[model samples]
Target: MHGVVLAVLLQATMAGGKHDYNAAFKSADESGKPLLILVGTNWCPGCVTMKRSVMPSLLRKGKLSEVAYAEVDADSQSGLAGKLMQGGSIPQLILYRKTSTGWRRKLLIGAQSEMTVTTLVDRAVEQQAALQAESAEQSVVTASHVEAAE
Candidate 1:
């Protein structure tokens, strides 16, 4: 609970950034925003480079200003981090969108440019919106069918 609150505050502090798994997941689910999780180890040179260069560059460019971003240390947050590492990649970017079944994820491995992240995020948002619209349409059709049956 405290973590969630802190995470919310963290988001507010850093323009939609959260380092806590629960915080990121909950916010993403609740707000219908795609969650971008960065998984890597602290000692990893790639991770350090990404942290020092790629992320900050994107942030400066305002590419990630509205993003629900989360950074996870693989060694510390094994539970959330392990699942993303199934493909055997470090400095992985995992984008998650909440769906009817659960969260659907898309992965981008290694360090990436701001343009790459921007393009991927744009597509993810569009895809999620389309899925949701389809689901809503199905729900309405199902309701109409049930009404017709009565």
Candidate 2:
């Protein structure tokens, strides 16, 4: 019984909760990962489905662990929602990559099946890895050029 209770508690704690847009962006920037922002209202059925069904499956598969996940309530946090949306619809899933200028939106739109969401997340991770590698190469080249100049 004690073991069972401990397992349940651990699961509950590991499961993520709702987050704001800025917090999500900041986390992604700090971690060098992408941001997944779910924008919707409490009253939206699709939003509830996304939170309960799709997100959990992705989490179980460790798809979202590499990125920051956030939820913005459309009705309650209208201002933040609007800014994140930029005049988009509710139940929107926006994926942003951290860049020098800021977090640049990569993908924007609805919740998908577990497979689809996983695939999208995987693709984003691959893209981020490539970008980081490219940046590292450029930095090395720049350093070599500076050494030659000196």
Best by TM-score: 2
Give per-residue CA lDDT, model 2, range 1-150, as digits (tens). 999999996775444344556677788878899888888876778787787788877878787998888877777678878887856655788788766566667554665677777777788888888888988999999999999999
Q: Give the TM-score of candidate 1.
A: 0.70
Cα lDDT tens digits, model 1, 18-78, are: 3666787777878787888888877888888777788778778877654577888787667
> Candidate 2 has what TM-score?
0.78
Q: Pick the candidate with the highest lDDT.
A: 1
Candidate 1 RMSD computed on C-alpha atoms after optimal superposition onto the true structure: 6.6
Q: Lowest lDDT 10-mer window, candidate 1?
A: 12-21
Clashing pairs in 2: none
Clashing residue pairs in candidate 1 (N, C-alpha, C atoms within 3 angstroms): none
TM-score for all models, in order of appearance: 0.70, 0.78
